[model samples]
Target: MAETAKPAPAPEASAGPVSAAGAYLAAGVASSEADYAAAVEWYGRALSGDPANPALLQGALMAHVGTGDMVGAAKLAQAFQAAGGKSQIATVVLIAGDAKRQDYAAILKEQAAGGSAGAVLDDLVKAWAKLGLGRMSEATEAFDKMAKTKGLEAFGLYHKALALASAGDYEGAENILSGKAGGSFPLTRRGLIATVEILSQLERNPEAVALIDRNFQPGTDLEIDDLRRRLDAGEPLPFTIVRNAGDGIGEVFYSMANAVKGDADASFTLLHARAAAYLRPDNTEAILLVAGLLEQQRQHVLATAAYATVSPSDPNFHAAEIGRANATFAAGHPEAALEILQALARTHGDILAVQLALADGMRREKRYDEAFKAYDAAIKMVPNPGPGHWVLFYSRGVVSDALRHYDAAEADFRRAMALNPNQPELLNYLGYSLVDQGRKLDEALGLIKRAVLMQPDSGAILDSLGWAYYRLERYRDAVLPMEQASQRMPVDATVTDHLGDVYWAVGRKREAEYQWRRALSYDPDEKLAARLRLKLAKGLDAVLAAEGAAPLKPVAAAAAQP
Candidate 1:
């Protein structure tokens, strides 16, 4: 919503105006989809004809920054201002360039001139800009001022701690992080790792080891485990989380980027992410964050490139590779995704995330046996699994059901329910399966009813509930929920098909045929489509009779009542 994620592309009226119209609209759609490179390309094409179009210039600049091309953004910034455009993003990019060159005066001048991205951004960057000028007291006071503002205290205090640590004031940083300096700070991976490195700096290796153990479970990451082992063995850990004011500034952008991620437009999010990566090129976490934001934008190629920058020896390398695999998968290269995950499973077999990724890839490809085996491997990694592992059971249940091992599927679903008793998906799946088999009518109804209560807005769950009622011969009860489900999921072939069957059972013959035709139009799978055609040709009851089945009225209804 912020800044429309990208400028509206020009309309393509009258065949193609190429600029100020057609190409501009093309740029808008591309940028909106997070195809920044494509947006840039189209914007460039449009700008050649309408040189002073503020929207096109702004869109091009955003796309440039999204790809971490600060130089291109800076060049566009000049053109934007000359074109009488006031773009906050252009100003930020230029300010970032100044920060990169250690030109604090230039950055401060822009802030003084009322050119800023926003209040929090301006203050934090100004704080770091003061540090670039070697004015430690002024920088601390600036951070303190931001801390006094409502809702900004946490971010301010966290940055202040980073600045203090970078300025060789470990005691001040420790006081803030340990909550002795007032309010408690939110925990993050970077923040926790910073505390560990700081504790190590003070020669409190035992405390650091204890802190890591207390905050994180065993084997949280290979790097953390390595750090703990070294700490216990009395190795002196270096204070390298933030070595300079620029790195602290990078942390500022990275933190805010994470905070406003989904709420803000992807283009706006990339602005801060770009600054984080630019200010501290070696910060692996920031780099990974950049790739993640790009992945959300669906800029898969760029995400893959950003993720590939993290070295394998880095603690966050597996995290980066996982992101890369996902990006590859999203880019319509599931085979490439599978290859990365399969390699990761071999290299980091003990890591549950790697095993899960392999399993997920297999599941997506419909290679059920491989996915099941991978899930088994993943389940073994957790000696005593808890609620967090419920998804593993649920996913394996899906595979089991596809293979027609109903007993195994039911057991997995029930085990998942034990772990997460109120999980809607588990309830719906188990309930629908029981309903389909015409067994445990009361139990199935109870589970699905609870599921509907939890996720009343879910189209799929509503359809399941309706199908359960239909199986129980409560034709009248099935109609309303099925209608709602079809409306909610208008394109879902299965829901439409179920609606058709219910309509037929209730003697709405024309409505049933229309619903069946609508379902077919949605392109169902081959088997379902064939069965639907048979229903249309012979009618539901006649088709049942041909298969030596009981008529829809007495036998099927009686069998469902236990």
Candidate 2:
């Protein structure tokens, strides 16, 4: 991604002030392209010329933070603030650095002076910092103040529970999580873990068991199953979610990061994630969250680097590897993804998540036989898999069909539908395949109708239903859905071609010619193009005769014969 040297700046530019704006523009381009290192370098070049440029200074800070350089980010933040930049990024970076050294007074000072860090985050961090400073009453007040924020009942109450637990007040933590104190809130996975630890601390195993049973579906998640067994056996679950005040503060940032995920751009969220990582280097959950945000922004290299920090011994290591491999694959490095999966398959063979990711990557890379084997291995790990596993069968079915194992593919597709009868994708794939083979026309039409009802807005599913009707010689019925699918998926050659055939069947010769020409413009595969060309010149009946196929039979003709 390195750029070659360009021509020098204008003599007027050299005689006047340096073009920091131009350097910032280049940095922005690199950051958007996922080249954080290049962005950092360019932003630094900008800063050297215009040291007080708030926009350029914060831009460099973000690049440094995005690359996980807390030290460098802190230094840049100091320079930015001294230059009167008024940066929330700088405030958060400085606050994180202070928190890392356990300097609670710095956090309080920043808050007392009216924070440059975001208002919500400033208050939350202050509460956790108070806990670290051994001022329990003040910490409680800050948490209560946060709880009073409109529509933030869950976040505030959740943090207050963590504050209690970290101080060995497990009974108080239990009150909040169990809804006996602080109004009700939906328990997230991390919240559930905290509650489990709290209940175990109070030796209330039965309540913890009930909580697990209420939250998770029967035989759904392995983590839930293990937690249930340990609680049943009267084993105490450790409070690992927030082990200290520092970790609690990190959790505060992580919670806000999740809350703002959809509403904010990636750069803003990346700042909070970076702070969390700084406080707890061993926080695998936080680390993975950071990597995921980077991936969303297309910063795949930085994401992969972040993912690599989770060691093999960590419980979240497989999850990290899966994410890293996906990032590597997405960065036009499929071989890297394949290499990691191959190693992981040998090392973590029993883990279904790892196996599934490996299988999916192989399937994407067109290693069909290897994908089938990996998918089967992943399936076997689950005895009597449930509706959640329809994806495994569905994916395997696709590879099976591609490999021309049609019978096996059909069986897989049927099993997937049986497992999840309402899944529109399963309905569409199976129905479309049957229709394409010119068999079970009635059943195919019914399945496709059900699928269309479930996912009326899905262009692919709509196309499948339309194709089913067309193959049934229900030309009139096909037209509406075919046209709708074409409208939604305008660039799809298959949908365009299908519409052309439906038009031809209805005797709209000019419209049929128009659609075929349109499909050709969109670039159908060579074989489909050749067939389309024959139809354009000789008509459907003549083309069928040349290919040793019977002429199309409309539904009425078949019904009359019966």
- Highest lDDT among the candidates is held by which one? 1
Per-residue CA lDDT of candidate 1, range 1-562, in tens?
Answer: 0233533443432354554576777887887787777777788888999878787888889989887788898888878878887768987787777877778888888878777778888889899889978999999999999888899998888888888888778888988998889678787877888888888888899999989998877776777888898999999887777787666767778888889888997777789888888888778877887898887776788999999988887877888899999999988899999999888888887788888888988999999999999998888887787997899999999888888889999999999999989899899999998888778988999999999999999998999889998888887788899999999999888999999999888878799999999999898999989989999998999887897865776534543554
- The lDDT values for all models are 0.84, 0.83
Candidate 2 per-residue lDDT, tens place, 1-562, comes to 2454442333233454446677777777776665677778778777788878777878888779988999998888878877777668888888888888888888888767655677778878888988899999999988887788898778788999999898899998888888898778888777887898788888988999998888887444656677889999999888878887888888887787777876898788888988988888887767988999988877788899999999887766778898999999988899999999889888887788888999999999999999999999988987887888998899999889889888999999988988888998888888888888888988988998899899899888889888887776677778889999999998788998889888877778789888888888887889999988988999877888898976777545633432
User: Candidate 2 — which pairs collide?
Assistant: none
Measured over all alpha carbons after superposition, the RMSD of each candidate to the real structure, in angstroms, is 4.0, 4.9
How many clashing residue pairs appear in each of the predictions shown? 5, 0
List TM-scores for all candidates, in order. 0.88, 0.86
lDDT of 2: 0.83
Pick the TM-score winner: 1
